[model samples]
Target chain A: GIQVEQSPPDLILQEGANSTLRCNFSDSVNNLQWFHQNPWGQLINLFYIPSGTKQNGRLSATTVATERYSLLYISSSQTTDSGVYFCAVDTQEGGAQKLVFGQGTRLTINP
Target chain B: GAGVSQSPRYKVAKRGQDVALRCDPISGHVSLFWYQQALGQGPEFLTYFQNEAQLDKSGLPSDRFFAERPEGSVSTLKIQRTQQEDSAVYLCASSLGGRGRRETQYFGPGTRLLVL
Candidate 1:
């Protein structure tokens, strides 16, 4: 079993602020994804970066496979971005894409 | 294309009752997953299905929990003899499948369950 730990478990900021959330895993994994769980309990896919770096709009993610960690950067955050950010990973062995999620970083952006 | 959808956005059941939750994955997607999310926590894996075959169910909390995807598209998770501890949000996800690196797993708005 791989362990995923997220830093800054809780964050609060004003609108237009920037924040960085981190995720560290214990073992090598081929399936690492970033997700945003909205207030309605919908887990939206933010990024699927097992390694390397990717950017979408104001959200960006970078994963260092060798270091077994990933980071999600929220730039110019908005009130709509307030929610729980999760990092999930599944091993290359026999996990069969079953993702194990971290506890998550709870972000609150006040308007 | 429509994203994943779940029925009965919320459910309330008496302690000894049985509840079944349904999930409809994205069309043409080959992989589906079920997870349990407790309050203020991330989702924990419960099961995985590749089409109609369940590949992993080690995360199931107990025998009271069961899931099936007989047609390889829709899935149902059933919980029998529910207890207060069984209350939580059940999430379903789907992804395009193959080997090696894979695509993102699109998730449905989960079903919230409450037992009393």
Candidate 2:
């Protein structure tokens, strides 16, 4: 079983500030995803980057598979971004393709 | 196209009672999965189904937990003799591809179960 760890378990920033969240996995992974769990508990998919970099609006993610780590960056954060950000990876054990999620980073933005 | 949808967004069960949760994955999705997320913790895999065949269920905590997908579109997860520890948010996810493919999984609004 692979272990996923998210850094800065808690983060707070001004509406116009920027932040970065990191996820480190103990083993190699075949798929990686980032999600934002809103206050209503919906897991909104943010990115599906197993490697390289991708940008979606104010959110961007980069996964360095060789280093077994990934980074999520939020630029000019908005108050609506307040919620839990999760980093999940698939080790593809026995071809099951189940995702293993990190403890998550709780982000708060002040308006 | 609609995403995955779950029924009875919340449930309350007493100890020793049996509870069933339903998951309606996106139409034509070949893979479905179930996960459990405890308070303040990340979701953990419970079971997985590739079409009508359940290929992996090693993540199930115990024999009391059961999951099935008879027709390969909709699935159900049942817990027999639920205990207090069974309280958690049950999530259902579906992917467009079968095993070994790198596909994005879309999750439904999870069903929050509280066992008293």
Candidate 3:
């Protein structure tokens, strides 16, 4: 089993501020994704970057597979972005599409 | 549905009671997954299905938990003799592909289960 750990378990920022979140994994992964869980408990997929970097709107993510770490960046955060951010990984050992999720980063962007 | 949908949104069950949770994945999606999330915790893998066949269920906590996707489109998770520890949010997700790592899993709102 692979272990995934997220840093800064709790975070708060101004609406216009920027923040960085990190996720570390103990094993090699075939797939990695960043998700935003809203207050209503919907897991919204943010990025599917198993490796390399990707950006979407005010959010971006970079995964350094060799280092077994990934980072998510939120630029000019909005109040609506307040929620729990999760990083999940799918390892090669499990070919059945199971994902190991990190503890999660609880983010609060205050307006 | 365009995305994974789960029902009922919330459920309360007594100890030793049996409950069934349903998940409707995206049409034509080949991979379906079930996850459990405790309060303030991230989702943990519970089971997985590739089409009508359940390929992996090693994440199931006990024999009392069971899942099936008979037609490969809709799936159900059954928990018998539920205990207080069974209280958690159950999530369902679906992906377009199963083999490639590029597959993106779309998650549902999840079902909140409270075992009293």
Candidate 4:
């Protein structure tokens, strides 16, 4: 019951440009977050990593997690960062906190 | 109410009627979740509570969907006769448990149901 794959489902950047979004998971994880469903949907919570690097200004994230993959970096982007950018996981490693989302990465910031 | 606050943000039933969605966590939260978003995907576990017990509803998809959190804060998700695929958008998360199983949930700003 663990499968999450999000990768450039759709993206269009311009304002300041700089993007790299990806998240892949299939197993081994107690939790892993990184959401931002703005545009009035408000599910914001940028990074919980669940493994490695993390930054919260220019927006950065990196979770190797033994190759499970996870990388989100939006450098100088603006335009409110557009919308949808989620990558959740909770492979039940620790149980209780079920989450397994990943059909996002629809960012469009053209200003 | 710093976060996790959901309510009648939007609801328009008709199919079979009987709907009740509400959640307000984030005040000494002790685990509380219920998600089901279906417009572009993402957000799908249907239930789980620790305070008022409700272990997990196993994603609840049938039985007309139902959830409650009695005296463990505030939570309710009842979708009786409703149909039309139950529409979409209906999230409500909360964490900060005893700091064990895992933390950081906090999500709310959803509840856009439309079954007609």
Candidate 5:
């Protein structure tokens, strides 16, 4: 099984600030995704970057497959961004697409 | 078009009772999956279905758990003889394609189960 570890387990910052979250995997992965779990517990898809970089609005993500790690960047964060951000990966063993998720980074932005 | 939808947003069952949670995935999606998330922890895979066939259930915690996607579009996760340890948020996700594809999984709101 592959291990996924996220850094800065807990983060708090003032609104309009920027932040970065990192995820490190123990092995190679075929699929990687980022999600934001809101206060109501809905897992909102942020990005699906198995490799390379992508940006959407104030959120962006970059995955270095060879390095076995990924980064999520949030610029000009707002108070509504307070929640847990998760990084998940799929190893596709035996053609199975089960996701192994990291413990998540709890982010809090104060207005 | 809609994302994954789940039923009984919250549930409470006494020990030894049985409960069933339902998930309706996005239309035309071929891959459905079930996961369990404990308090303050990441979600763990439980089972996966490619159409009506269940390919893998290795992540199921015990024999008391069962899942089925008979029609290939909807899925149900059933837990029998529940214990206190079974309390957690059960999440359902679906992707557009089958195994080996790089499709993004869309998740439902999840059903929170509390076993007393």
Candidate 6:
């Protein structure tokens, strides 16, 4: 089993601010993903970056597989982006693509 | 085209009663997963299914918890003799991974369960 730790457990930002969340894993993982849990509790898939970098509008993610770490960047944050952002990892030996999740970074974007 | 959908959105059950939650994965997706999320916490893995076969259920909290994906598409999680500790959000996710490491898991809205 792999252990995942997220930094800055809690964050508060004003609209239009920028924030960066980080995730670090204990072991080598082949896949890493970023998710956003909205206020209504829906887990929205944000990025599926196993390696390299990807961007979707105001959200972007970068995973350095060699370093066993990943970062999620929220630029010009909006109130709608306020929620729990999670990072999950899939180890090389896990069965059926089972994902082990981190404790999550709770972000509050105030208007 | 459809994403993962969960039923009953919310459930309230008395302690010691049984409850069943359902999840409908996306069409043509081959991998399914179930997770339990406590308040203000990330989702914890509960089980994994490949088609109709369950590959990993080690994350199940107790023997009273069981899940099945008989048709390889829709899955059900049944909790017998539930207790107050069972209160949490049950999340279901599905991906296109068949055998290898494909980690794109599209999640559902999740079913919030309350045991009193």
Per-candidate DockQ values are 0.67, 0.79, 0.68, 0.24, 0.81, 0.74
Clashing residue pairs, backbone N/CA/C < 3 A, model 6: none
Instruction: Name the runs in model 5 displaced over 4 angstroms.
Output: none
Runs in model 1 with CA error above 4 Å? B98-101
Candidate 4 lDDT over residue span A1-111, tens digit each = 778899989999899999999999988787799998998888988888889998988999999998898999999999999999999988664457788899999999999
Winner on TM-score (4 vs 6): 6
The alpha-carbon lDDT assigned to residue A70 of candidate 1 equals: 99
Candidate with best DockQ = 5
Q: TM-score for the first chain of model 4?
A: 0.33
Model 4: residues with Cα > 4 Å off, grouped in runs: A1-14, A17-29, A35-49, A53-60, A63-72, A78-80, A84-91, A94-97, A100-110, B1-12, B18-34, B37-44, B47-63, B66-79, B83-112
Interface RMSD list for the candidates: 2.0, 1.3, 1.9, 10.0, 1.2, 1.6
Q: Which stretches of candidate 6 lie over 4 Å from their true place?
A: none
lDDT of 3 by residue, B3-45 (tens): 7899999999999999999999999899999999999899999
Q: 2 or 5: which has the higher DockQ?
A: 5
Task: Give per-residue CA lDDT, model 5, range B1-116, as digits (tens).
Answer: 48999999999999999999999999999999999999999999999999999999999999999999999998999999999999999999999999878789999999999999
TM-scores of the models, in the order given: 0.97, 0.98, 0.97, 0.34, 0.99, 0.97
- What C-alpha lDDT, on a 0 to 100 scale, does residue B33 get in candidate 3? 91
Clashes of 4: 0
TM-score of chain B of each: 0.96, 0.98, 0.97, 0.32, 0.98, 0.97
Ranking by lDDT: 5, 2, 3, 1, 6, 4
* Candidate 6 residue-wise lDDT, A6-96, digit = tens: 9889999999999999999999887889999888999998998989999999889999998999999999999999999999998856457
For residues A1-111, could you state the per-residue lDDT of candidate 3 as single tens digits?
899999999999998999999999999998999999999999999999999999999999999999999999999999999999999998865477688899999999998
Cand. 6 TM to true fold = 0.97
Q: Candidate 5: deviation at residue A111, Å?
A: 0.8
- Which 10-residue span in candidate 2 chain B carries the lowest summed lDDT? B1-10
